[model samples]
Target chain A: MAFTLDEAQRIVSIALNHGRDAGWNPLSAVVLDAGGHPIAFARSDGASPGRYAIAEAKAYGAIMLGMGGRAQMARAEAQAYFMGTVNGVFGGKVLPVPGGVLVRDLDGAVIGAVGVTGDSSDNDAEAACAGITAVGYTPEP
Target chain B: MAFTLDEAQRIVSIALNHGRDAGWNPLSAVVLDAGGHPIAFARSDGASPGRYAIAEAKAYGAIMLGMGGRAQMARAEAQAYFMGTVNGVFGGKVLPVPGGVLVRDLDGAVIGAVGVTGDSSDNDAEAACAGITAVGYTPEP
Candidate 1:
């Protein structure tokens, strides 16, 4: 199934609300289609100006690598030199941060990804996972 | 009203479809929020890799100047020195090209902007205008 715009907005709202309800700092979230293109994004009132770009880049990296940001981080750690070169090639679009999570449909296909920012890396990841779960999809974290 | 993600995606789809129905070249379209951050984007098959960046830059220029790209071009023509300075300040993010249009709510407040590329400049602007009108919004061109 296509990763519809409705689903992308739902994911962003759910992720941001989860962070807000937990009394976390204001967050920015981005949802990207499988092609590494943004589908939806939102930045809370107090989020830093740069959070929007960071969130989109994180989600782009996840969809590009077909894995969660944490998993991409692990790979980056194992191949630091290679990842650095890859990052340069992508003009720094690949951010191997912990906040990006892959969204998988019921058929086990990667449909898109969600990225959250404005909290600790682990907390960001949790918020993204929570959003995916809320939308009845699997979060490949 | 906020330019919702659903509206952004709808605009992109409608713009692309308009081009397709007219037998135009493959296109890339982008939707940006009021703050100039991308909300949605799509590049059709066979569209050049550069179209994405060009489309986004066009949209950004429109939103930044609070007018359509063609209008921005008029300003750029009338004040070449000033526009040159502005371009340098924005690090070339501002591109005064035809294909970018401002999206406005029913109340006539600027909500966001849409940019399309991969055809003649006037045709690109026409497609964007069509998309905004299809969604019952105003396209300032």
Candidate 2:
């Protein structure tokens, strides 16, 4: 089944909640379905204006590459030249950072991805995973 | 004064509420500050994936051109060749059409712009004006 809008909003809400509870900086969260289209997005009240774009790009890259942010970072390191070309193609939207988390269904199929930005990359990824797990989905981070 | 995030979110919320109350199709709303960066955005559950992009572009164009969507439309008609080059410079984000409304402060200075989509252009513009007026700002459409 395709990702529902409610689920996407819930993911964003939960991710922001996690950030707030942890006393992290204001956050932005974006949920993208398997098709690499945003299902829902939100930026916290104090988040910088660019937060939404960064969060969306993180999720977009994760969903498009079929890997979590860490793996993308590793690949970016291993294949710098190729990644440079890919980043150009994606219009610099492929940020290989730790804030992107892949969501998986019971059958281990990729369903969508969640991206959070504001705090450090590790905290961002932690918030993303928290949201995915709260929604009863596995997070590949 | 700069636009606050709370005001932006309220605009999106009220715009979507107007669309629902009018029984129009699912809609997307985007609020961009004077600097042409999004402060808040939302797409109704059934809105198509591209709604966000369209809504954003509409508001971006209005804010960048210092006019409402109707004025932008007129400019597009009168200066199609120039508009083509301008659109290219903005990376095709200048959608000169109805549904974009300029938000003005009490002193009549442009503060921001709101864009709504997913219905007829007239209906979309109506919804955007509703939200802006509800927030006590004038809508220049």
Off by over 4 Å in 2: none
DockQ numbers for every candidate?
Answer: 0.17, 0.47
On the 0 to 100 scale, the lDDT of residue A74 in model 1 is 91
Q: How well is candidate 2 docked (DockQ)?
A: 0.47
Question: Residue A114 lDDT in model 1?
Answer: 87
Indicate which candidate wins on lDDT: 2
Structural similarity to truth (TM-score) of each candidate: 0.65, 0.91
iRMSD (Å) of candidate 2? 2.1
lDDT tens digits by residue: candidate 1, B32-109: 888887766676766664676788888988888888988888988899887778767777777787998998777778
Candidate 2 collision pairs: none
lDDT digits (tens) for residues B11-72 of candidate 2: 88888889999899998898888777777777887788898889988898888888898988
Assess each prediction's global lDDT (C-alpha) against the native: 0.81, 0.84
